[model samples]
Target: MSNRSRANRPTPDLSDANNPHAQKAQNFGPSAKRLFGILGQDKNTLIVVFIFSVLSVGLTVLGPWLLGKATNVVFEGFLSKQFPEGTTKDLVIAQLQAQGDTNQASMLENMNLVPGSGIDFDRLASILLLVLGAYLLGSIFSLIQARILNRIVQDAMNRLRIQVEEKIHRLPLSYFDSIKRGDLLSRVTNDVDNIGQSLQQTLSQAITSLLTVIGVLVMMFIISPLLALVALVSIPITIAITVVVAKRSQKLFTDQWKQTGVLNARVEETYSGHAVVKVFGHQKDVQEAFDEENDSVYKASFGAQFVSGIIMPSMMFVGNLSYVAIAVVGGLQVASGSLSIGAVQSFIQYSRQFTQPLSQLGSMANLLQSGVASAERVFELLDEKEQDPDPLTPATVAHSANRLEFKDVSFGYTEDNTLISNLNLEVRSGSTIAIVGPTGAGKTTLVNLIMRFYDINEGSLTLGNTADSAIDVRTMTRADLRSRTGMVLQDTWLFAGTIRENILYGRPDATEEDMVAAARAAYVDRFVHALPDGYDTVLDDEAVNLSVGERQLITIARAFLANPRLLILDEATSSVDTRTELLIQRAMSKLRQDRTAFVIAHRLSTIRDANLILMMEHGEIVEHGNHRELMEKQGAYWTLYNSQFQAPAQHESQTDGDHI
Candidate 1:
């Protein structure tokens, strides 16, 4: 079905060899089942396609039969030209029998020739016209069938695309962390697209090819059972060839697609980290890697196509042998007057029709294998377990439910590997709390739990109007909880849009005056006024046209625009210049006012004035107090704080004493 072997075809990813989806398709049976499941949703349309296909194929088979009738006319006209005038067919047979020509006598008895009649041109013309009409009607029906099939395929693919999008949204962040982004994208885009193309290319043709064969066989039998049997003999040979070639080609197809993914992944990696490659001077290494992957894909594809190409000629070989047998056998019968020459001619045509479709099916085998392999890859994604479903009815919470608490919270990313154990903490509605720790100290993990980016294995994370009136965070809808919370990370995200629109994304319905106020609060207005376009300056891809500090300020402005009840800042000023850092700190201070805030800081000095500070170590809270109180105790917080300020680890004690 897909004739352009060199053209880019769908390559379902197999880069992750251990992934369950990497397995290749083994049979058309499963592909048919999956395709039918999608088709069944529009049963009425398929019924229409089936009916038209039958009509189309029926007319196609009728063409040879009509041509046979025309052949009979011409043959009879020639014999009638030789017959004596005023002689009847009965008299001719009687005369032939008296002459001792038994075969002639038997043939004369079957002839429909009229005495003294020349060629009947009018009758011949009429029969010829009917043959043309049958073929023409068949073509019209085929066109209609094809049009409807395309529509059905397009609609089915649309539904599938939507399903993939929704599934991706429901998948947890951890799921993304576990797999290559490229592989997942292949499942979403290429795999689904290939399924649609494969179904569209193969579905109607497969149906038509099948129907044509059956209809032609019936016609052959009706004309002469002997010829039909001769043609039928090739079917076994055809099946054996198909099975042998298809089995091997399927494996090659798998290798082709697998290597395609590898090549694609290498390309993605090279381009994504081109700067790193350039700095390290590894361009030649990347080029070599790409060539290796590309060559593997090429060889695999060539092998699959070459092996599959064998089936076409193999089918033709069998069909030609059958054709020779039918011609020879029918000629003998015609000579004996047991069968007409026209019947033999029609049988020859039927033999050709039968083998042509068989050959086509052989060709479709490779395309079908590729398509089904992609379908299986996509199906695996669809079958993945979704995130925990939302509550049928969420528990209601008061408008002022901002006070946060974690009670008896014990959780881990995986079972048997607890990260936070028996954690307990509570915060008032309006408090700026800071969490400081080294890497892997459960600081960000704690923030992730609060934002519900991940559902904890065991924890009671709740928010309340007051300390005693708490409701579980899970009780509220995700949208509802997130709507009241906003976050700004150290690595800011600013999309490709105007500065105004970027800020407006946080609160779409905010007035212009309110937007400017937030922008001013985040010091975004200070930078915007300096630019020629100010608020309307369009950012480029990844907003790369702007400085990092400028991008960071825009995000902070966006968060401020939302006026969220709860705010989370991941060391907002850690990557900025000193002046920008001070500006951001002031902006955050204003934004955090009257809002419950959690600031995860890398620099301990930045959170010196926070209402409370928690020093975390190995998922445990080692110290908790105001900055001055912790410094007075000279414990874990004091030690960690002094470490950052110390000249070097070798002179840590004196630095600690001096700082204290």
Candidate 2:
């Protein structure tokens, strides 16, 4: 495809304003369903949690009921004089019996007999003990339930992180090109973290709160149906308010996350190119751009949080109103003698208990929304199609050969702009082919095709000793193809590890002796021996400790250790000094022996010894001949060589043999 066309391709929209859910339901793609599915996978744990949660609520109700009972006993014995001396023991027993029976005769028996003051103290102490026990059990089990739920959440999070990482590695390169690096990083790090936090803090709490609410309502209804109904009336109103607020904040949070990514990208870009910025005196301009993005992120985050913040207070307001209504109604019932003081107190306590969970649910709404937003981003990445599918039954090659051929191959990144069309090429075993081309002339693209980095859109690429029984490049596994192809690019990438580690990266199982031999051949051993730690010397990001020439030599050493049949050198020595270039040329000379090599170089002087040179222009071979034949033709190669060779001595001195 034309570079202009690719550069102008429409970017995908990630803005919250474009999403329908921003205006209505707070749903984030299929994340809601997928999250529920993940939670449902641990049904046993959830079920156990539900049971424990119910037990906890049951204990909570029992605590307040026991407290109310004890209060009534003390009041009757002390204030009302209902249980005076001598009859107090009987009164206590009768009270307990009445509580179990709930009949008018049992209560009358207690009122008529109880008169012992010491007995009243003993009964009150027993009731207090029961309440204490319920509280103790409730506290202990609540901790246990929380611990168990946390483990479940952590396990699920671990699984999710692994899945997301695997998906990231499997995704096509095109997908990466389409999305911002910072956004992907946010999805993996920030979004996944949000999901985990939500699970830990909000999801489990919401479930437990729900169980508590239901259990409280059941207890309240059992005590007084009228009071339970009054409490229930406020629930829907609280939920409606919470839902409306949550819906408003969901999109806002999504936008906040996206803005964070933009801000992160800006920071990453600036930090990575700090040297360039300083050289160009654009630090202020960069800072201004950063400030703009930072402001957007701050506004979005504050707005989302503000909307979410209103939910808890709104719920608390409704809960307080419900408490007042229940209090007034229950007091009237008690005063009219239809309800006991103990029963009215129990109903009021239960009403608060019911509202507590609803209050918690309201508070958890923000977390829920954030989790949904994060999940949507994560799932979107996971859902992207992979570049290559693993072969169901892979084909195997019995033997290795150096011959490579591209016959009538027509290919392009896009349909309208063809990079290579009707191109035919064949390389004999153990021969060097140098490809010379201007920028945008498909030089690197041709090498990319040969390595099967991309498959041809039309025609076949074959590799074998002969064309008759040639093996199609697509039929062979990518790993197998890559293993047999050695590549050295202009930019050398060294990971943060020991020098030996980087050298052996191409063949992890290579022996120390084999590594040293390859390093010696690539002229890397010369520099390594001078280092403080020899092969054990550690490298940092971009190997900033090493010069450009040294890094390139190390990369060459890695490729040398790979020892593949096909070698591709893409402007490999472009950034090195003249003396270092000579060393690299010597290494390349040894490396190219008996190998089918495709060398791309701008400096015509370096490839003079190549068996054949193909000069390319506008994705087509404009001239093809040996070095002398191209010079004799006085074509594109002649013009290029003359232009470069006629440059000032200083400019020529600055050039590394193969670099433009």
Candidate 3:
């Protein structure tokens, strides 16, 4: 599939959805919106699980009602003689008949509570069994719903993690240059992890707590609306307190995450560059830097947690006050013969059920806020633009002997500083072209443009003969373009894998014979065979086990294996010893055969056989010609060659031509 198609596919926007700062208020409307969105993603599972949750909530209410009924049954048996001496039995029968207005009462009466009555003990045992069964069924439903919700959250997090990773891969390289590696890492790792945790712990619990509150309020109103109204007065007060605390906590959590990123960056830098620190005897300096960052992280985290911590206790205080108010009012009503003891008991239970979830929800507000902070960072990354759009409908390329051409190309990373302007060049197929210049002459930038790592700001680059037939690099797929190009750089990077794997990285489907041939050509086979495991030896981190020269050889071998139509060797032999440089030069000679090659080298001797040499200065070509033609001109090329290359040779000759 095309890279564009792969990138455009719909994925979870975890960052946007989870951002704490983005959520304005903790109202039921917004919470329900988020909840429904999550559920809508997998409606089938949500529907089934929601049904089970409702059944569980309904059954939970039945347990309290059943207990109340059983309590009344016990009280009636004791009060039977208080009704009237002779009419006691009649009164008892009348009470039972009145209570048997519901199906549950009928079920209860079948067990028989009348004194001296032939009550069936077996039936009573069965009624007790039914009560136990109801409780167990409710517990089972709760467990099932909890598990399903947890799975939904986990799956959503998984999808979000994958989306962030894909965005990172597709984002422009320039974006990374402007952003800290540690900060990006924190967003993907730390932020996403927080979201997952919040979903698992806070999200499911919040839902259950909300349902509990609603169910309890309904029950409370049924028993006594006057008492319920008194209890509910504390809600607005509690919410006001929660809102103020949540606002402060959100800011603190955001600051905490920012500080965490800074700390992570400092730690990563210190560890990664430990060798440099020790070599420079800067251990104390590094330690102080680390301590500063660590202190920042600690302070920010402590303040955020401390501020958020106040919410739970505050909620409890409000809840306790509300509870006392309900009790005082309820007791007065019962004393005045306006309420029953059973109704009072049920109302108190419902009040506790109502306030308990609200308190728990308050406690989890901080975690939810932290998750939001994380989401903001993740979304920022996802929203970044990709390097350049690949062609929606690309033009086909037919085989041709056409040369690569740069026509009045001007480029810059940013608008204020132009690297190269009105630059023009031509590189024929199967020709060796050398680009020689002083430092910062845009040599590497030119190479980057050729590979389409960055597009030029102005002008055009053509790959064919006719300007009308020229193909834009952006119009071609990156994978296809990269497959046709090969590069070997000064700082060779070998991934942590076997030597065989590193060499075959460019062409995973290559035959073993092809790999061996490429390795032999790149002169990498000599070192490989000398190792204990030959090509099977695994490389360590950064390939520190291999010498710099050996790493260069491996990279060269990779290029050879790919066998691209175009080759770029950017100071490939600069860091090696004389003998190794010779080996690399020999490998380059073979690799450059029948391919268009661009060589960027500091050493002038390496490019003496180039078909054409372009001498550059200040991001512009000053002179261009072959070795003899440049020497004959006695111009900029001659001046550079005599000073930089010839003077070194003359000095060496005076020292008996030492091989360097």
Model 3: which residue pairs collide? Answer: 19-372, 20-372
- Candidates, ranked, lDDT: 1, 2, 3
lDDT of 2 by residue, 72-171 (tens): 7765665335445554555566665667754443444433234544237788899999988898898878877888888888888888899998897677
- Cα lDDT listed for each candidate: 0.82, 0.79, 0.75
| Per-residue lDDT over 546-622 for candidate 1, one digit per residue giving the tens place of the 0 to 100 score | 88888988888899999899999887776679888877787788777888999988788789989999998877888
Clashing pairs in 2: 84-115, 84-116, 85-115, 86-116, 87-114, 87-115, 87-116, 88-115, 88-116
Model 1 regions lying over 4 Å from their true place: 1-28, 82-109, 494-498, 528-541, 648-660
Candidate RMSDs in Å, in order, are: 6.4, 5.5, 7.3
Task: Please report the candidate that would top lDDT against the real structure.
Answer: 1
Q: Give the number of colliding residue pairs in candidate 2.
A: 9
What lDDT is reached at residue 483 by model 1? 89
Cα lDDT of model 3 overall? Answer: 0.75
lDDT of 3 at 331: 84
- Candidate 1: minimum summed lDDT over ten consecutive residues — where? 1-10
In angstroms, the error of model 3 at 249 is 1.4
